[model samples]
Target chain A: MILIRVHKECKRFISKCLKHNINLITIKSDKDDLIVKIHDNDLEEIVRLNYYSQIEIIKYYGIKGVLLNLRKYFFDYIMLLIFLIALYFISNIIIKIDINHENTALKERVNGLLIEKGIEVFTYRKDITDLNEISNAIVEENKDFLDWMSINRVGMKYVVSFEERIINDISEESGNCHIVAKKDGVITKIVADHGVTLVEKGDYVREGDIIISGEITLNEEVKDTTCASGEVLGETWYKVNITVPFAYQDKKYSDKSRYNFYLNGNYFYKKNYDHYDEEVIFKLDIFGNNFKIVKQKEYELSDLQYTKEEARKIALEESSKRLLEKIGQNSTVLEQKVLKETVNNSTIEMEIFIVVEENIGTTRMFEVGEEIDTE
Target chain B: MLDIIKSYISNEKFYIIIMDSAIYIKNYSKIINIADDEIIIEISGTLYKIKGSSFSLTKSINRELEIKGYVESVDKL
Candidate 1:
């Protein structure tokens, strides 16, 4: 709505002129001010009369004026139109490809394979159907490594998942072998099948000694040869050495923290600390614009003193942890004892002896035409 | 052809549009009287009296004017 500012007596003058039929045109009043619509000739005549009222143009509007302005700034409108088109085109393409696998090499291989099949980052989603065919082809090409594969599209990103094939050992299938001791130990128990037991309980055995023989004899003549399979349990000992320090430096954090933000490599607040832990709150990258928020927590390091009991407990725990790591996963711990412990001014040293019952027999394949050298 | 041109140029027929709470007039000639509750407008050679509460003139251009308020009645005078 447009409004014209005029003198206070403008309404009275216009109304008097209208009554005289002086072609005064449209005239309306608010208290003392008047709104008048007159032709150019009539307005000129009014001004010539030198009336006490004044007039001023306040606002104007028409379709022709709007179209003229749009024509004048045509390039800006064109740029806006192009920007919208580009946004629509970019949103439909894949921005990232995430392969869910623990092995980096396998993930890279799968990604390379997908790219070779015309599927990768920045590829249009509409152009990349037939994912099942692609996955089948990949699995077929990598049958020895990939057991199953699948691809899924999620919000401009392609998520790929696959499982690796696990190959079993083939030596167990061929039973033409003998059981030999893998480590020197005392035999605690033995159970033999399809072979002759060469070691008995409480018998001292050495590494590379045959525990079970695969040869079978009948009437003092060679009958047949089969793989010797048995479980020979033996008691193995290990000595674990560990040292614990009485004084150490530990990190202590303050209750206060500060937040910082960055946009396109420019920091919002510039404050640096010597000892602080930074945690990323959020990071965003859209159309090459980067933004990040980080929280920094300040901390200090202080010396901590340990008592005799604390040092001894730490030493024992460390020794036991070291011994457990040395023992294999399938072995059972039979007994454990701390053989010796020595305490110094600032350190404590200890030796732990561990005895475990484990399978000591390993298969040794023999050639069929080889002479039996049982010396 | 000259007569047609003269007729087209001299065409001064008035048009009045009464919408909800607003009145628009084209080819308006004058304003006869204006009050807080009523307003009288001259268009072509006839007078139109608009009665309402809190009447206001919102806009004015060449031969055109717009009135806005609670319009109760419109009568030709």
Candidate 2:
């Protein structure tokens, strides 16, 4: 606004301004002319009203008279708006999930269950009541595998605690049954409680051969038939073939790394090195925009050559591990020997034989349509 | 009959209210004249003149304005 003094014919000028749809605000009659306050918007055309004039602007008003002052800080305000939006969404994101279980398969099962319940990392955090509802539903769905489960949120992490179901064993009574050899092995020990012991320690037995007969005999004659029960520990053999490369590539990380930012799906940097690893450090969502910070570390590839002796050692370890996976974990490894070895230009292959002490007894009934060759 | 006139005129009615020290006028056509003691405006094809003392516009837009002063009388001219 500007306060102006119109020298002559002020009413005619005001009427002319109103005729042209321009408003004259705050008018006051002076001794000779009229002093008026007019906005800067109508100043241009009102200046051309008359040349014989005494219209002069005396006073200027506030900073809002020029609208360009607000337009200069437009980018700054937009940046501030984006920052506030990011803070809002980032505070509601789930970052980590910790399952308190020592077993790997059980941990994987619980993790899968959590994902099915919509409680996964990088998703929005659920309310406490909703999380409790989901946990109860999961426990109800998997009643056999899980006995109890609870989910609690601490900061950005969801800690899941659970206990597995404990099953009881009910052994059936052995009646008219004989302990036979399940596999071809040499007997290491035997403990018979009933019937008669047909084989002693260090006795080599084949499959389908009964180690404890279901008959009571004296002086090489059958007196009676009774149910036999016993445990037979035997030395079992396993053959494993392993192949390993003579040259192996190893990746060792260096201390040099670069932190780069990403918006939406486009990264902000070019590939500086030919070989490097990228890891996501942090991420945020601002409205519909995605922001991520990634760390890129450059590494050098080096090939380490292995000798025949070193390859043999590695093959032995691998063969033992494979044999253990095939058998149960309770069996003990007795002995291992290299049966054959083949060496190629860049690889080493070995065939190894492993001996283990394990239970080799399987029960067989006497008169239940089974052919019992006790002769 | 009122609906017939409102349909052509867009249903805009001229309304004015007098307060202690301010006068609010809505839907007036244009300003005919303005002075320290009198303000004349056109509303409904008739001139409405407001006699006041030390009249100054407190707020204004395209079709609305608030005049701050001591209002003495309002007459249809």
Best-matching candidate per TM-score: 2
lDDT of 1 by residue, A68-140 (tens): 6688778998998999987886787677889999999999999899989766765566333588888889999
Instruction: Give lDDT tens digits, candidate 2, residues A1-375.
Output: 877889987657765666776667766667878788888877777888654566897766677634444566778778989999877766778889999989999999999999887787777778899989999999999999999999999988899999998764211443577889999999999999776888999999998889988777689776777677778899999888899999988788877889898988788997776678999888655446777899999898898988999989988988887777787776778999989999999999988899999889887777644557744
The window of 10 residues in a row where model 1 chain A has the poorest summed lDDT is A16-25
Query: Candidate 1: misplaced stretches above 4 Å?
Result: A1-153, A172-175, A186-204, A210-234, A251-300, A326-342, A357-361, A369-375, B1-77
lDDT of 1: 0.74
Q: Residue A182 error for model 1, in Å?
A: 2.4
Lowest summed lDDT across 10 adjacent residues in model 2 chain A is found at A166-175
In candidate 2, list every pair of residues with a backbone clash: none
Give per-model TM-scores.
0.47, 0.49
lDDT per residue for candidate 2 within B30-60, as digits (tens), equals: 8876777999999879999999897766544
At residue A223, give the lDDT of candidate 2: 75
